[model samples]
Target chain A: MPVTAVLHTETRVVRRLTTDFPALIAPDETAVDVTGLDINLSGGFTVLELDNSLRPASPEEALESGVDEAAAGARRKTRHRAASVALGAAAADPLSHTSLREALTKLRLAMYGE
Target chain B: MGLSVKTGSFVTETATGSKAYTGLGFQPKVLLLWSVGGVTAGTFRTGAYTSVGFGTDSTHRAALGWSSQNGQNFSNCARTQGPNVLDLVQWDVTTHIRADLVSMDSDGFTLNYTTVNATAKIVHYLAIGGSDITSCTVLDWPCGVATGNKVVTGVGFQPDAVMHLSIGEPSSGSSLQADARLSFGMMEAGGGQWSNVIYSVDNSGTSDSQRHQQTGKCIQKLTTTPSVNMAAQFVSMDSDGFTVNFTSVTGVAERVFSLCLKGGSHSLGSFSAITSGGPAQDSPSLGLAPLTYLLSSFNSSGQASPIGSTRWSLGGSDGTSEETAWANDTDALGTSASDTLSKTDKAIVICSATPAVLGEADHSALGSDVFTLTWSTVPVTAHELLYWAIGAGAAPAARIPRWLPVMRTHDPRPLDAVA
Candidate 1:
């Protein structure tokens, strides 16, 4: 990450959430604003934008729209088979350790407020 | 082979020294020290490295957090000064380099300056090593002191070695102190050269005659380090970021400091003698990533005593290893958290506290600072404007995204009010 710590995402908010997704993270006096989130996202309406290229080898337009049948070639030939099916579905996740200890106990109860 | 960079400078008189091969050739794994001040007083250990070790086992070593004098100037940086320590400035200091002193048989490596009243003067060295550098990062902090034709946007990866130091303001009105230091590297000769060291405080032999300015070659890809015949001005070198116009020959109110090194793509990574910082042999840009840099401390033209240090000591001591998967996911850009930039250059992170161990270590996994993530809007050369990366759960999904959503950062404990 010495690639100058990688954050080159200059002003490009192309939103499209549908219901409510906020809580991406907050502080600096609780700063959230996913268009002031109301709440929604089982994976229905999701189109947010901030791009610079995720480079974990997706994107030939996310392999022509979310890995469509490995999208018939191109993009350095499906980037080594989408980095081997996204690292074999994250090493065949078996609920990866109780979803990582319940996301570190909801991140230690939202970072120790209790 | 891959990353090898070399350059030399010596001036201590009463304390210590070393350098000059007559023909040098190759072998050195890493070394970067810059004093410019006078090395005010005590501190700066390890000299005879057959493996290459000088500073960074976690601060207090690189001669009191890398001094130009304590902040009279550091690469041209003082930034209000006080012990920010820039996360002990590392990635280049896998805990204070000393693998055996990284190739001492031939290509340079051995610097010792402890104390004798500390005021001999002149210290500017950059000696890298190569077995095939594999991966590297060295930016040496201090990013402001501008005016005239300013550009500087290096350090975003893709360098084969680049260095620049424009220090002025140690004496107020700035008349002339030799050439007033303006160095550039990435040379095998003929192609890259632009010199002017701390020849006491700046002296191109007396007055910037022609130290070495082949065409004043810069660097790029922006980071690669290794050196045989680099002979650079590389232009794009690889271009993840590059732009350094610089115009401080007394451009006005003068104060500048730039050091960029990304050594080795190798076609040539050794050779020196066009002048300036001359006689280099090349090597040092080891195992890629971790130069988040920002540490400083200076003192000496008068006395208060503060010395030198250059870290990013670059990897080795794995819990998992690719250097710890590039130091665990270096998120650099994930986007959103008011827009980003508040990760405040503390720079060093190592195993990333934990995300099940993050990336497993290759080098670099720092991010989460830069404020509202705004950057006013890109292109000042754009190395992510100055820092980025914000994806872990809620969004920002990509642009360098990886993950880091623990209420955005740390938890000394006091959050949880948002329901």
Candidate 2:
């Protein structure tokens, strides 16, 4: 008898974040100009207005204190919380016969960081 | 491991005439070692050979001589069978022989039965020989072979099937090589068969046959330069727009730009007809009376002043105003000598005489001649005009006026007198 062997495996990762934030508008505002808002996720996460007048606040504080009153002053300001999430899966030796259940189990473990 | 022949018993036999009676019975078991040569041989012997005698009877004598030697005389001889014993003659013999014996030849005189046995081993060797056959056939060729044991006479007897055969090496050092070539040729004489020829014509390379050439009179090219200056030079004789030919500083020769005076009070009624290399003819001549009051500007936006070359300002109304000073530059005929024109200034011409009424006869009409000419004492006007007589022998005459009262007065006369 002759024998042949093949191997297959897969890896997956998923990261998720969710938060609430506050938005502000002037009392006599017609349309909100959000073009100046910059959301940077390159180094951790940070959100800022292109204009110098606004100030930043924590995600918790932004949700606790609403945006309407905080933006009422002359130099209006608001706090917004942003989340960056991703999910990905990769496989090796995919052509080989292997237990799909086992590959999926490994992928799930990798995604959950368990 | 060694062979030892022992005599168990012996007896004497006497034959008296044909009736030799000898009751001799002794077990004679001979261990035979047979050697045979050649290709066809058996691996083992089937039956047993023994030597014994019970009586001198013919049937018993044959059996007793089973151990007798027929031709060669030897001091020690292996057991042999007589020619008359046909049953034992057909036994197979093999090459290479060895034997171990615990029995001996004996003659008995009423002996009880005793058993003797011997062990022998025979070995056989075999060799095989073979030769190879060679065959080949072209691909896709129709071929057949006989289906049954009967000889096939015609093509109909052969059945269709793929013939698969193998080729073997003819000799140990020989090598086989096969070569083949495939070629194709096509000829197209006088448009050969369309089916056999491949055609890839690109009709897109040719111009579309459906396109039609535009039919109309040649249009003249109009060269125009927009201006903001109210006092721009112009050639007045060109009823059409005037063409200004200027040599570019960059060595471009004879670049022409046209300038036309728009008419009406607002100078707003501008007509842009196509112009050619030479003077362009006026097409559908527009009425210039309505554009009199229009402030003419050199630029399309009309934001700058046409006079003094600056910001927008009201064009003066009076004929002597600076804005209207463009009129002072007019020629003797009251047409602008240069291309410039004042804002409020305009050219005016007055006719010296009124045209005569038809069908009213009087002293001025002259008598009822076939062709008559009437003369006006008024001075010759300063304009070109043509007159026609609606009678026999009458022809029109062109009148060029230079002054109002220079010509002599004369009474009505006949057409011949005027001629």
Top-scoring candidate (lDDT): 1
lDDT of 2 by residue, B1-419 (tens): 01111111111112211111122232322111111111111111112112211111122211111111111111001122221111111111110121112222243112111111122211110000111101111111111111101111211211111111111111121112110000001101111100000000001111100000000100001000111000111111122211111100111011111111111011111111111221111111111111011111111121121111111111111111111111011111211111111111111111110111111101122123211112222212221111111111111122221111223223234434444
Q: In model 1, how many backbone clashes occur? A: 123
Write down the TM-score for model 1: 0.24
Tell me the deviation in Å of residue A58 in model 1.
64
- Superposing all C-alpha atoms, what RMSD in Å does each candidate have to the true structure? 26.4, 64.3
Residue ranges of candidate 2 with Cα displaced over 4 Å:
A1-114, B1-268, B273-295, B300-419
Give one digit per residue, the lDDT tens place, for model 1 in A1-114.
000111111222111111112211111112123333322222221223333221232233323332221142233334534544554454456766767655655543332212
What is the interface root-mean-square deviation of candidate 1? 26.8
DockQ of each: 0.01, 0.01
